[model samples]
Target: METVSLTINGKKIVTEKGKRVLWAALENGIFIPHLCAIEENPLPFGSCRLCFVEIEGKKEPVASCTEEVTDGMIVDTRTESVLRLVRMAFKLIMSRHPIICRECPANKKCALQDISREMGFKLKPKRLPQILPDLPVDDSHSLFTYNPNLCVLCGLCVYICNEIVKEAILDFNFRGFITKVGTFKNRPLAESKCNSCLKCVEACPVGALSRK
Candidate 1:
């Protein structure tokens, strides 16, 4: 409940103490590009790297979605180093993302697609591995399908299902690079207590989870 004042993008703003930099920036009307931090969800899941910002007194750049705002803090929402890092992060995220923009239903409406174009990533990176793994597509559920390959591991779906819906149906199955979101016992979502809620599908920024 405590309040603090900070300078973000040269604008003075007051926010509650311990508020994440992302929430403070948004509340103050400073739009920093972000994908994984949804307002209704508490889990930050700062994997996107799109909300990186330069904060004074910090050695390296920190993720706005995860960094807590401090009093009298000087935060640069857009800087040369921050832009470079963001652009690179965009490229990396796009590398594994499916290139179904022209043929897929989401297409222009896709958040990832829109963000990539906005960031001026015209061509995909060639240095990164071209061979992407194929994850199972779960179509048994009447409402949605689970395609782990397209997932950016943003955890938005997991958060929505567990935190918002209170279903606790989906979760990460493994660890490290092999990790993928799945239901308990790796059963189909239809077999779980999912309640056929489409909140998870709606929360997914990418086509990793979609309504069928």
Candidate 2:
């Protein structure tokens, strides 16, 4: 494993070459607001662009989840532009997520909630448009519930089930804004090959997937 040196927030740090900027900052106790970035998942989801970082010589803030560390890199994780991008991303995520945090089961443990507080942003919609049409809660499984309304479409479950678990039961159902996770033919998860392993439930960052 090759090593590279980079500067994050004016602190010089050395990391393995090809390490994702988000994980590198996190391992060193430097917080970079992010969601949909599971260390176990290899591919970058990039659905939530909250991990944007301003790198020297680069005109725009790059998605830290997809950017690899390089030698002599000057990375600014809290630049004005980077903060603006991250704040907007959190706002967009909250617009679709229900604002009634007090009643939510994952309120205290929610990554979205923690990151919003850290970034000094409110979870209120703030005029950002809502996403996905109304979706019914799939309570077919006795142990778990699936609510598409709270889903951020991070695809962590899809990746885990399809790639990691090799279950091939769960996947995105539609294209673009209409996309939603489901079993083939929209069948109930209990009726599908879910096996009730709860891997998908664990991968979900929001209360979209939860144990009943």
Candidate 3:
């Protein structure tokens, strides 16, 4: 792999030529808030919109996951514009995810909790009303539980299930505010052809999918 050098947050770092800014910064010990970023997936959709970064000469911040690094590139991960976008993205994601962590399986082990602690953001955004899907918990799998109400719709579970695990059992169902990860025809996991690989549960950042 061809290597290139770039500057991120005043620190010069060298990385592979085609690496995305997100991976480059992360590998070099720079933390830019992100979700819905899977290194294996080449075509990132930037859905979470939390990895925004200010690049030199760019009019607006760009999602680092979808932006490839270039030699001698200058990147600022915490500019005013970057923070505005990241804070809003975090707020929007948290608006949909329930903040009741005490009873959740992930609890201290959740990614949202980590992001909250790292970014100094609240788990529940004030003024932004929570719009939970209020879907029923699917405990029929016998190995894990699926709680749609707590899902942040980061698409990690769906991508892992369909792309990595090749289970093809989970995807975004419905659209817009009502969207959620579900089986085809909205059937329960018990009726679907799930192999119980549990990759989806492991990929879940929040507690939407958790082991029993």
Candidate 4:
């Protein structure tokens, strides 16, 4: 395979050409804070925006998951500006996302929680007022529950359903602040076209979709 040379955190490395920056760093044992990234998924989902990296000559840090590695690129995985943006983004996400970390089953397993801890954050709800209202949970499926309150809208479930599973049973509804992943026509999972694959539940980084 073709290769490209790049520098990440001042360490020079060579990776496959056209590979995503996040994967390149990770392939070489460099951890760039990220969520919504699964190695099996071929496409990049830049929903989390937590994998921001400062590329030299760029005015702002770009989402590493979507940005491809180019030859001679200089990347900084950790910078004050990158950390600040990540924290701010997490704060906003956590404000609307319910924080029942104490009793939550995914407390230790959640990607958001992991990133928060890595950033030296407490994972507490910030003072930012929520723009979205709480929604009812969907436990119609026999195998799992769908809790919109805990959803970070990372679209991993939807991606797995549509692309990986090829069922297209789960999808987004509404728009803007009201957007959410749901069954077609607001139907329940059991009643929808879901094939009981349980891929969506496994793809969820948080407890938004959990086994029942």
Q: Which candidate's TM-score is highest? A: 3
On residues 42-113, what C-alpha lDDT tens digit does candidate 1 reach at each position? 568777899999999888888898888888999997788888898888778767666766755466667777
Model 4 bad stretches (over 4 Å): 39-43, 125-127, 130-132
Cα deviation in Å at residue 179, candidate 2? 2.6
**lDDT score for residue 124 of model 2:** 78
Q: What lDDT tens digits, residue by residue, belong to model 3 across residues 34-77?
A: 77988999988689889999999899999999999999999999
Candidate order by decreasing TM-score: 3, 2, 4, 1
Off by over 4 Å in 3: none
The better candidate by lDDT, 3 or 4, is: 3
Backbone clash count, each prediction separately? 0, 0, 0, 0
RMSD of each: 2.6, 1.8, 1.2, 1.9
How well is each residue in 1-212 modelled by candidate 4, as lDDT tens digits? 99999999999999899789999998888877776777667676777778899999999999999888999999998899998888887877877776788777577899878877777865774677656557888889898998887888888888889888898888998887767899889888779978888988888889889997
Candidate 2 residue spans exceeding 4 A from truth: 129-133
What would the TM-scores of all predictions be? 0.83, 0.92, 0.96, 0.91
Better of 3 and 4 by TM-score: 3
> Relative to the unseen true structure, what is the C-alpha lDDT of residue 40 in candidate 4, on a scale of 0 to 100?
66
Clashing pairs in 3: none
- What range of 10 consecutive residues in model 2 has the weakest lDDT sum? 125-134
TM-score of 3: 0.96
Deviation (Å) of 198 in candidate 3: 1.0
